[model samples]
Target: MDFWEADELAAHRATARAWAEANIEPHWAEEQHRTGCHQTMELHARLARDGILAAGWPAEYGGSDVDPAFAQAIFDECAERDLHVDGWTTTSMVLHTIAHTGTEAQKHEYIPAALRGEILIALGYSEPDSGSDAAAAKTTAVRDGDTWVINGQKMFTSTAQVCSHIFVLTRTNPDVPKHKGLSLFLVPTSAPGYDLQPIHTLGGQVTNATFFTDVRVPGSALIGEPDGGWNVMRVALIYERGVSSPSRIEKTLAEDLASWAREARRPDGTTVLDDPLVAERIGRIAVDEEVGRLLGRWTNWQAAKGGIPGVEGSMRKLFFTEAEQRHFSDALDILGAEGLLAPEAPGAPAGGAFEHGFRAAVVTTVYGGTSEILRDIIAQRHLGLPRNRPGG
Candidate 1:
């Protein structure tokens, strides 16, 4: 009826708490606010050394080399502290692809450095014209003797200004179907003709609009087989979602909401905790948050056993994102006018978390994949429904 961790894992979470108090807490949020990024390499290396950064990966590939639960316990430590790094959550996706599908030299070139925090790569999948329909990418990769010349523009690149490389998806063959013609490449940020401009987000952070003009990387930059990039995206997104999460972000956020409300007082000076309606809402959030963890745990167990589970990623992402939006919106309603105050405003409730989270929730529904798209995925792939309907 309930989920509880083993005593050892609880102790591991406690160690993570101490680690945060000593290293991450003092500098992390200020750095993120200052540069629109939270990319402290020293801190990143610390996480990697402490076996937190690797999450659930195996030892030979530079992972913390622990089982998924231990890795997740560490991740929770970071989330509770509000600690973050721009690309740390995603770097392993790139590493896993390299370790599995890359040539021996490519594996040697990327994986170790990535694990050591010397190299970081952003997911260069979304484009200017593309949001959910990722298969329609128009960026092209042309072979020039031993080099592949890349020309394309990408949007929603969260860590472009700070990362060392981008794992780009490009069209290598235009004549084939849109999905089959794509390829992925690991193009270093140092390559000439690469440009990035900032895109400010409602969440008070910066992502980027990145352009590649005649950016050249050797044939060795390719990951997996040519025309097989779609599969690479498929693999990467499973990790990007909560299946391999270090700290279970959505669950933590939901928990924080309940904690904030307990201390929040209505204009009548009674704590929100004393109000039955607020109690009901908080109880609903707790239920949904628990459901999300159950979904993630089931799928994460599958990932630990060496497979992506059956559509659990879609289910988890869909429920948590939608719930995140609702949780903040409901908090705003519960907090009355004080909830609308800006973060750090003198009268703001819970340090204006509701206003900030309300804005952040807008992007949650769109990123990774939209709720509409995930619904279709569940309907078709998970439920075995017809893909195309004739005048539904």
Candidate 2:
């Protein structure tokens, strides 16, 4: 894999960086100041209007039809500036799957509007009893004439409070095996019987517990063939797990730590950064960041070649999340008690970003998929090992 971006991507990155500085930088601190999920419709629309939101999508779907790397360039710019695109990320995952598997009518109705940032979709996969076992969903959707009546709950439904719809996984045919009985739906959050309550995490992020009590959606809401949701979900998870864009958190943290260390002094009056141990730890972080970036680039390259990343997604996901955990631990240790300070606290290093990141990194290993589960996937799917779970 090329360590450097191609000329076209490099030029695109320059443009994206300028756009982010003008549009995102001014408001970024305010967004960060807020406790959780701070995406706003104004910013979302601006991203679309600037052609950054869907740059890699097909031309008919409000995109420029450039290589997928173009979209990744936009993401890298945002991350370098500490701009949160969680809302767009989840929406894109669902939209990508829809573009591939949805009916023509469904495509016509949702695609353009979503790209224009008129609608947002939240993931509704985890249930109270089904954390990593998404196929074991108990959320039922029963067909009644032309409508489907849904009744159940979804946990960790991030962005539900602000999203227009939820890409839900429901048990449509419980008589069949767990994975075979499922279906997917694009349920409107505005519909009656739909409700959500917030779930605050230590990371200062807000997810939700969503409830559906006889929620009725038209047949058009069905994303793919009934009992074929597992396959549809696999596609969406590929987008989620795959390193379509590299995460800059670890990189940012290391930079911040180095900056703080440069200004910090030891009791002996020498700079903390002058210490060999501190330098070695930061060096380790840089190495990890580069490896993770290359892994992401490999997966993105596959997508650019019109192939969806398979177990390679699992590999990147596992490596990146675990590396993130390790990076933060090292950061906190280097920063000492001052590192634990919250953002608003006086004299906090890098505005307490490392502190908040330390907390935030805790969930990276849990969401999307757990580290343990990802390892199992890598073993069974990538390594050709027998399934560790029973009855496999």
Candidate 3:
């Protein structure tokens, strides 16, 4: 598909650039790199009030109702400026799914609230034993009178500490097969009997481990249908991977690497970027960033035309994440001994962003879906190949 932005989109891009320049705090990028915290809800609310956060949603739902290309331009601009838009993007995707499949009452109640940036939703698909094997989820939700009683634990749930609600998957019937008996529910974080514990990672981000002991919600909390959460989750997963932009991580690393290469002098007073090898490495990373952008545009085009991203989304997710890891690894190699310094050290390069990135990149390959799983989908579904065996 032709993925170039059109004239109207270019106009939108200009507007986005100006808005970002005027409003984005000067220290926001450095703060995000150092603390791993995006702007607060007050900042989010300001963006929402200015119609930036709801750029792609329909007008009736408090969005701009702009074309998908326009939305892509906005995302590109945000990435170019080194902004953290993942939390906002994920919330919008979940809101879109609700608009498409939710009951009228659900849309009336949640869509406006989400667009207003009043409610932050956390995804609850992963469990201690069911990370990639989401179908093996054992979280149970039993019907009692007019409510569902949930009892299970969810692990590696990002942003659960600050979210208002959780879009969770639970097994409604055990007699059914692994993928058959699951159901999706919108559980309020304030619900009685729900407990959350933060999981600190090597990279310093805080994900969560949540336990539900007789957590009860009304039957209205169910989304789509009972014993059908697998399908709902499949749809949500497609949106998650497809709408994701590589700009945040890629831009942050690229700009940092360039700045460091320009400033760090060799033993003979030669700068790193002046080295042919360093130039080649940066060129390759730039190419990967361009390709990832095109892949994202293609995914958006498909969605705009009423088709799901399918295998293409997996390809983009796998390629871009791996590219991010490779880009930073090359930076570390260029820095040599200086790269080993921790962020807390007195004179570390880029405040140890590369060091943190290396550890974080290891987790990226495993999260969402592993590179191995994405490769399997590409072969089986995209290439129409018979499943590979040990020696096949």
Each prediction's total of clashing residue pairs, residues at least 3 apart in sequence or on different chains, is: 3, 0, 0
Shift of residue 375 alpha carbon in model 3, Å: 1.0
lDDT of 1 by residue, 1-392 (tens): 13575443665666556766776757676676656684667778786676666555555656666555565666666666555665876677677666656887888778877877778998899998987888888889998999899998999887878899999999999998887888999989999999999999988778999999999999999997888888877777766664645555344545666687677666799887788888888888878878877777667667666776547888888888898888888888877777899876897866676798799789877888889988887999888998765532
Top-down TM-score ranking = 2, 1, 3
Assess every candidate by TM-score.
0.91, 0.94, 0.89
- Which sections of candidate 3 miss by over 4 Å? 3-10, 25-39, 65-82, 246-256, 387-392
| Best lDDT among the predictions, by candidate number | 2
Relative to the unseen true structure, what is the Cα RMSD of model 1?
2.8
Candidate 3 positional error at 316, Å: 0.2
lDDT of 2 by residue, 1-392 (tens): 56675444675677667766677656664575485874566768777786667677777767755445555566677676666767778888888788878988888789888988889999999999998899999999999999999999999999788899999999999898899999999999999999999999988888899999999999999999988999999999998898434443224556777888899998899998999999999989878887886777778778667678878888888898799889989988988888889888999888878888889889989999899998999998878898888963
Which scores greater on TM-score, model 2 or model 3? 2
Model 3 lDDT per residue over 185-294, tens place: 88999999999997877666667899889999999989878898887888888887776652422355666688889988998999989999998887787788888767
